[model samples]
Target chain A: MNNEHAEVMEMHMPTEKIVGQTDLYSIKSSTVRTPDAMPRPIRVKAREVNVFYGSKQALFDVSIDVPERAVTAFIGPSGCGKSTFLRCFNRMNDTIEGSKVTGRIELDGADIYDGSIDVVELRARIGMVFQKPNPFPKSIYENVAYGPRIHGLASAKGDLDRIVETSLQKAGLWNEVKDRLHEPGTGLSGGQQQRLCIARAIAVSPEVILMDEPCSALDPIATAKVEELIDELRENYTIVIVTHSMQQAARVSQRTAMFHLGYLVEEGPTDKMFTNPEEKRTQDYITGRFG
Target chain B: MNSLIVATLLLILIGFAYQVGWSRSRQVAPAGGRLHSRPNYHGARVAIWALVPALLILGLWAFFSDAASRAFVMAQLPSDVRAMGGSELAQALSRIEQIATGFGVVGEPAPYESAAGQALREFRNLAFALVVAAAAGTGALGLYLARRRIAPRLRARDEVERVVRYLLIACSVVAILTTIGIVASLLTEALRFFTFVSPIDFFFGTVWNPRFSTVGAGTGEYGLLPLLWGTVMIASIAMLVSLPIGLMTAVYLTQYARPNIRNAVKPVVEVLAGIPTIVYGFFALVTVGPFLAGIGDLVGLDIRATSALTAGIVMGIMIIPFISSLSDDIIRQVPRAMRDGSLGLGATQSETIRRVILPAALPGIVGAFLLAVSRAIGETMIVVLAAGNSPYLRLNPGEPVSTVTVTIVNQLTGDTDFASPQSLVAFALGLTLFLMTLILNVVALFIVRRYREQYE
Candidate 1:
């Protein structure tokens, strides 16, 4: 019975390229483009950013620029400081006790770590999704309304209701959950809960969204759905995702930065990085040779 | 023999049996075949077999030997003495028993008493000897059988495990049976109390006076309402004082305080629970009671030194650690991801705690509060000391009041006649208290279970 159900599910799914497929790295190496070819303005810029947890330095003098209206994927092995750097943009590292960040990280020309910058306001502008689907143990409607309610983005109850509806619709979870809006968010399936988290982040109308391996805990079908959502979100929100899966980075990100041992190995368009890379570490990491 | 000697002998025999079985199992192993269980399992199986039969025999002997000796003595007695009424027969048997044990009777005994005492002494020695021999014989037989069964294919380990499981079950049954025994005794005694005072009058009467009177005089009016009201009032005051303070303390410890500060302060706060309730009682009586009375005097309000207010405040102080520690643990149990989810949405730390963490932790906190209320309700020493023992139905916190626990203490202490309504009423009060706490615990468990379902 289970086998038949799985077959039916596979038939209904879109014919997306599976992981480890041969066609994944089929982008021609000859097609290289200069920086002038893509004229999107830089949304966030980092210069020699170093993060330290206690006395141990995690990210060492790493620098990268994220362009507007694009998905920038940070791809590396475990403990490569990709998630650490992702947290730096929204000043999440400040929440960690005894962990200090040095060097400048700017959001749209303003340094977020500056003394005048409010961490709470900066986080509202730059929302984050975590590695695991973590929804509040509240009703689905309450989960979506939490962000806008906290920020007072809605003037009235109707506005809050509208924001919740539009956010869930944007997350592509409104149809499956619209009838059960009063049910607990945690009661949903893992993939649905993840979409609820995305809707919660989107309810605040963030300009930028940072995702730290958002699909790592999901199955393949769920991963595809989230990747599709990331692609859809890129038209309005500047997206930065840290993923362990190189294929996921190649599929979802327009600009990909390769990190190795707390250093930026290479940064360029996804196709160029996958097909022809300037650094051997990037080549070795991408081709399943060595991490 | 005495139980200690029998126990020592049994231990020695078990050790010998274990050694014999271990060596026998090794000898019985086939030339090229492995044993199903190790030598240790065979040895354990033999030891348990040797111990159980002997222990059962010893237990049976300990249970019946005294009665057997008494029956033997009664059988030897002359018809005239045997036909004596209950008290006379009991006295004669005790005198003979004393004589047999070499504590001679005070006056010259009759000829029949002397002869019977001598016969009783001989019978006791024979009975003890017979019991010892039976126990030893059964133990040896069991050891031999167990050793003979220990072959290559024998499942000694499984047998030993089964025995051990039975032993554990027996231990748990002992605990459960003890609680059942206590409840049964309370029910019986409380029923006995109802014979003297009608249940309706005892439950609903407003007057609370129990006078010493003859069997049918009916002088006491054992009303439960006054004490119940006092208990409710005191517990409510305690809850009012402790709930907000304890909850806020938990929030600060879990959400606001630094790790080092939390670690240091948490144990110090918990030390409040470790303080003996009697010490708190003394503090309430000597310090807080007079202080409140002084304050009352300054405000031109009459407050007794020992009043519900004083006792409630002290009991609240005593229960703070219980609420705070339990609540701290519950609030901390809120998943870190939940906190991060709220904080990630640009919510401030306080906002995250107030909206997300607190709501998630609410059921558990409510469970903690209920448990604290039960603790406060059941508290004895503080109430006994500070709550003035005035069995009157009064609403004012400034006046003296008595609680169910305090009345139970009063009714049971100081040469109580157990058959009288004055004393048996304590059992009824205890049963009521037990039921109240039982209901509270069940409610707490229900809330906690519901909370667990949401998370896990």
Candidate 2:
């Protein structure tokens, strides 16, 4: 585990140095994709998506297809628009002032950004976990119960308790927190808090869960546990994660999309993208040589 | 040879010591070797050493000079005059001091008085000169010793820092000592008051009519309950008016308003706090008082022009900024992640605020409320002008009431003898007010600390 963590750290070292060196304007639209032999049904499709903060463009015409019941990881250097694009899925960017998103995002064949669609319901259907563990400063049970209660997913006390239990169980946190469910979720360890956040997102029964660097703030041991939980969650929920660690993407994701300077450089099955990439930039990034 | 001239001379000497030390340190520096501290630190160390001892000597001299002069004057008096009683001795000493300072006595001075005055003047001038010379000599010695110690290995910065730390401690000690001194004086005066009126009667008595009486003729009822009741009633009413409006205003400013609107409106709201309470008193007396009475007449109610409700509503308006501004800052302190987490859970903005943000910010908001309550309780001007001084312990808000602060003002004003219970009772009221505010502040601090620990 330590060896793997060290390798992940080594993979991230070069990326940190390249920040503020890459000019956004010089990057052209270069997307190389490998067609899957056995294609899964798509859960979410974003097309020609462009994001801007005030007048400064953050994501430039980036598009991707997220397949159902599988993990797709967006891997990039810092400030490469991966998290920005992930936030676009849950419409979390709307919370930011003077932020504008121009494009269409479809979930299950309906435009999520359409005027008729309620943002509350759309967010309920698509939940998000932040870079840091953001469990509400509430009891452990209440943290998981927050979503189910707010979305009216549970009708009775028994139902809410059952929901909280199952969600915690699914996040693999039930055994550790069952006796201390009344305690504040913030008092939990970093790994437990992150799992609790995952449990909170799951309690709402979201069809898709968007995680932005979920394990970035966790230790190596906790990172492995969360990675294992992510693999299990992929069997039921369509998962899209934005990670800085390329090793994490290779380990957990079935498909990997690499973003550079606000542009999607290439995307394919994780194995093919890591071992034999079509784009020279993807190869360089994978081998820790690209600036 | 006055102390001011000595102080000015010491200042100049200290400046010269700094320059001398700087040059000495530079001369003592080894070739191609760095000193332990900069030249400025050495200079500052020397300057501090020069100033502190001189200031101490001057302070000691100033403290003892008056007593020494009085002793000398008494010794020089004729034996017959020296046998006078304490009051006569004091009178004789003042007359001699007046003569010495060239302020002539009421009538022609006696031979002994003139002789004593001349002797006192010569003695004072000689003593003053001697103290000044001693202070200057010790200051020069300190400057010379400090300058000799300035070398390449000398830790001048450390020494200077130690002095600076002591200076800071001295300043804080001064502040704490002042508070302790005020409390001690109040306690003594209040105890004196209790001697006239029993503590039980003053504290638990129902009526509060402190009439002036001659010594040993106790005929006043100094009850605390009525004034305390009035203060509580007025404060409750003020809290009732301010809490909801202040909290809502804070919520609107932090959660709902746009950046432009918040920027434009926040200062305007805080401007309410800067308006003098005296002006608010005037508004309560001239505007709110008459307005409420006019409305009462319309509704066939018998509301007095100067009533608890009028003063309370005006005081509430005056403290609106304290609650709103403090609550605004605290609500904003709730991490943005908490809000995002709630909003991501499919909660509406208001639902998120009501369920999460408000609960998370509840402790701090409660602390703000307590602070505003204390402010309301301590408020004097508004209640003085608007709440009529009935001191009847009435239950109705429409009727005029007198709070502890108003009563204290009433008792302290006019030509009243300080030794009388009527005047000394003001000290007891002041002490009670202080303790009440102090307790509220402590509770507020505890809540705020707990809130901080939970979040941070």
Candidate 3:
């Protein structure tokens, strides 16, 4: 279902004509076993995705697949529509009043944008954390427990408590915040607040997590903790992260998708995508020829 | 007005003098390395040192002048006029001024008129001398203080910061004191009313008929239950009409409307608030009241044209802008990321608002609604004109009613003596209204605090 018309029409995608080869010295080719090969059965596949806000088309026909239980990173310049396409994955675009998405997005072989889908239930399965921490104006424990309570994950008070505790522990924030469980979530430092948000998203036990520049608002230390958390979360959940920092995408993601304007430039194993890209646009962007 | 002019004048003089002092000091020791504060800060410090004292002196003098000047003129008056008692003495001085100014006396000139005019002229001269001397002494003291530290090492910035801190504190203290004064006045008047009418009777009595006077003159029965009920009914109607519509308009502005439409429509709504309540009152009175009565006649239902419904509906219109404007700001303040976060989790627009946004902004929205409710209750002009001057308690929106503000206005109109129970009733009603609004304001403050603490 991936339409190639948009990829050719978008002028913002950087173009690099390949006149020389032999730069890809370390990319595992067909000659070698690509360490950590992509698993069988993709969990989410987005095809021919074109998005528009009124008359302004933001994303061209972008197509990509997210394999289960691995982190996929979308790397691009500002306003490249990488995040826009990522939002389409969970039907997050539906929240925008006038924003329209015309494409097929299937999650677990079910049409995500189908008329009969329950948006609330879909959201419960695909949670997200934002660039800046957005913990509810409640206690640290309550912040973690909010999603579980809303989704009815816990039936009793003890179950709710245990869920909250486990979520915090998974987010790597329980030890520091255990003493202040009843204290305000916002009273924590920036790094701690980001963890609180992760704990919040995981409380409902979502199968997939979308992060929109999750570490952009944080300091180096906080960014490292979030990156580490992303790596750990990949063991159980599929994660798609939109990042401006190329180094960060390289650090945490097993697969990398490069977008320019609205077009999906290139995507594959992280190492191969970075070292040698089939598309000229991907090469220029990765080699810093132009933004 | 004169004090403002004098403060401005002194401030200018001090500013110029400060510049001169700083420039002269620098000239005496040119290129004094690492001068304390920038040159402007140094100049401001000196200017403040001079102006602050002079302003204080002038303000204190202005406050006391009326009494002090009156004392001076009265003491200097001849013994004959002084002995004529309070009213006579006042009349004599006014007549003397008229004669002296060549307006001529109303009839033949009285014998004491010329002497009175001379005494007044002397009093004016004495006042002028005293004010000038006081101002000069203040300027001198300020100059002496400012001159002592015209050096680079002076902690001029720190000194200025201290002065600014005190100035801000003093301004807020004035606002606090004014509130205290209003509350105290309300409390004292309510206490006086309570002495005549028991609190229990005023609160619970079903019937309201006044039979008040002195015990022998004509003891009046004062019952507040009917008035309270009417006020609450009208307010409830107003809130019911305004709250939902206002909140929806807020949602449209924040969520649905385009930026251009929002910009255009927002000011139009704000203009509704700017149009005085009296104008809305008149619209309710001259237009809506008759319109309702006509509808009532056609429907075969007995409806008073000038009824609580008319006033309450118009009051609701008056408050729509208030609610919409505040709710718009609160909803907009709920953060774009929160919506994105919810949406990214696959929630639709309405679902995101209901589940995440509205809950997050609930305290702020409630705060806005409460503030509008208080505005509806305290409003006077709409009810005074639109609603009939009847205090009977009834639940029907179409029936005649009166609000606390309307009752106060009805009792305290012109030509009535202030000492009568009818007139004093206004103060008692005012006290009750004040307390109600005060409670509402405190609740709004507390709810708004939660909104502020959302991400503290």
Candidate 4:
């Protein structure tokens, strides 16, 4: 029912004015596509998106589509607005003062910026995992139960316990922490803490999960663990991950979006993006020529 | 006068030692040998050595000179004049010394006393000259030894650093020793007071009526319960006003207020701390008291002009800045990641603060509250002038009450008889107040440490 309303809203979306453009000579137009590759139905459509912090622009008119139930990776050098663009999906950028977002971004065909949409509900639907493991200073059980409790998802104590157990199992942390459910979440190791945060986010059963450099602070073993969890999660949830490691992007994502100097240079299937990118900048980034 | 000359001489010797040491180190460095320390350090080490021993001698001589002079003068006095008791002899000696210093005495001194006074002047002069000469000679010896010891192998820098370390340790010990001294003196006097009144009576008696009797009469009711109740009452009221307002102000400054507003307002709030509590005392006495009484009159309640409510409100206003500033720092110290995590979990700002930030900053806020309580308990001027010093046991905030601090002030201010229990009670009250605040601070520290362990 809400999907039809969102579809009509996206069709009636007003055109946004493009700000300062980057001087990349080999930048591809927004309509450019790979040959013999069919387009997937869009779950999130960002059209003519421009973001600014105070007077300085952080993201140019960069448009892309995030397909449902697939892992989409945003890869960029530092301060290239990849994280900024990811924050826009859940309106997390609204928390930053003097940050202005003027664009049309639709989630499940609904305009997320519409006045009728509540931010709390929007954030619950689109959860995020940060670079550093930031579990609440609470018991492991309470950490997983936080979201479900806030959203009133559980009708009773047994239902809440089951939800917590299931969320932890989905995050691959249940077995290690099952006996110590009452211990503080912070008492866990770094990798375990990060997995606990994932469980915390998925506890709400969000449709989309945003991972902002989720594995950047993890070791190789931990990164591998989170990557495997991400792959497993792709069967149920639409995932958007921002990564500094191109190899991890290729390993975990089905689609890869490249951002450079505040511009979305090229985006396509991970196989094509790593093998033969459409833009020179994307190719240079993949080949380690220059950030 | 002789001491001043000796000090000047010691300073000059130190300066000369520094120059000589610097030249010697420079001379050594230019030779085939490497200098072990900088020329400045070599100079400083020599200067310290030269000044310290001489200063020690001077300090010891200054401490004992008067007693030694009097002893010498007394020994030369006639046996009949020295036959008097210790106190009487000391009094006669002071009178004689005053006459010798050209301050006129009440009556003519006896022939023996006049002779002793002349002897005293001569002995004092001799003693002063000996002390100055010895101190100067020691400084000269130290200077020569330090200069001779300065060589390529001399660890001047290391020696100087060691001296500095000792100096810093000595300075820190000074504070600890002073606290020990204060506690010791209070303990002794309180023990003396307990001899006059039983500890059980003082602690358990409900009535607080100190009769102001003579030293041995021991005819006063020194009950602590009423004063303790009053202190707790006022402190509770102060906390009731300060905790919520201070915490909210801190939250606003940290989470909600703009940078410009925070910058403008934080110092203004802190300025309340700088205002003399006496001024707040006047405000409570003149303004708040009358205002409350006026309101009470309108409501047909009997509220005195100088009631506990008035003093507590003013004290609470005084402590708001303390709570606000400390809690602000503690709340601000909470990692931004904590807030981000809560916000990302779809919590509103208030919800995040209530559920996460406040819980994280709880121990620190509790510490701040305890600090405010201690301040409220120890506050003298505000309670002295504002709390009407009624000394009556009452639970009503509308009535005037007396706190321990106000009673201590009342006992010690004027016409005090130190030997009597009335004046002596002040020390006992001080000791009790100190112990109470100490326990409060310890509890606060314990909570704060436990809280810190959770986050860090």
lDDT of 1 at B13: 89
Q: Which ten residues in a row have the lowest lDDT in candidate 2 chain A?
A: A24-33
Better-scoring candidate (TM-score), 3 or 4: 4
Q: For candidate 4, lDDT tens digit of each residue in B140-160? A: 888889988888878999999
Candidate 4, residue B288: the lDDT equals: 95
Ranking of candidates on DockQ, top first:
1, 2, 4, 3
DockQ of 3: 0.42
Q: Rank the candidates by lDDT, best first.
A: 1, 2, 4, 3
- For candidate 4, write residues A1-291 as lDDT tens digits: 146434533553434522222222123222122322455577899998999999999998989999988889999889989999999999989888789998899998889988999999988999999989998888999989988888899999999999999999999999999999999998998999999999999999999999999998889899989998998898799999999987788778889999876888789988778666766566666766556
Superposed Cα deviation of residue A150, candidate 1 (Å): 1.1
Q: TM-score for all predictions?
A: 0.94, 0.92, 0.78, 0.91
TM-score of 3: 0.78
Misplaced by over 4 Å in model 1 are A1-23, A26-37, B102-115, B213-216
Q: Tens-digit lDDT track for model 3 on A1-291?
A: 144534543453544454322333332232222336746569899888899998999988878899898889999878999888888877777767689999899999898899998878888898888889877666898778777766678999999999989999999999999999999887898889989999989888999998889999899988888888888888889999999877777677779999876777788988777776777667666666557
Per-residue lDDT tens digits for candidate 1, residues A1-291, read: 245434533444434423333455653222222222566899999999999999999888888999998889999889888999999999888788889999999999999989999989999999999999999988999999999998999999899999999999999999999999999898998888899999999999999999999999999899989988998898799999999988888878889999876777789988788877776567667766555
Model 2 alpha-carbon drift over 4 Å, by segment: A1-37, B1-4, B86-88, B103-115, B214-217
- DockQ comparisons of all candidates to the true complex: 0.63, 0.63, 0.42, 0.50
For candidate 2, lDDT tens digit of each residue in B1-456?
Answer: 465797689889888989988888899989999999999999999998888888888899879989899888878988888898689888988999999988999988888899999998899889878888888888899999888888899999999999999999999999999999999999999999999889999889999887755444666898999999999999999999999999999999999998999999999999999999999999999999999999999999989999999999999998889999999999999999899988988899999999899999999999999999999999999999999988988889999999999999998887778988899999999999999999999999999999999876
Per-residue lDDT tens digits of candidate 1, residues B339-391? 98899999999999999999999999999999998999999999999999898
Per-residue lDDT for B166-281 in model 3, tens only?
A: 99999999999998998788777777767767778766777666533433455365677788877888888899989988988888888888888999999998999899888998
| TM (chain A) per model | 0.89, 0.87, 0.88, 0.87
Worst 10 residues of 3 chain A by lDDT: A26-35
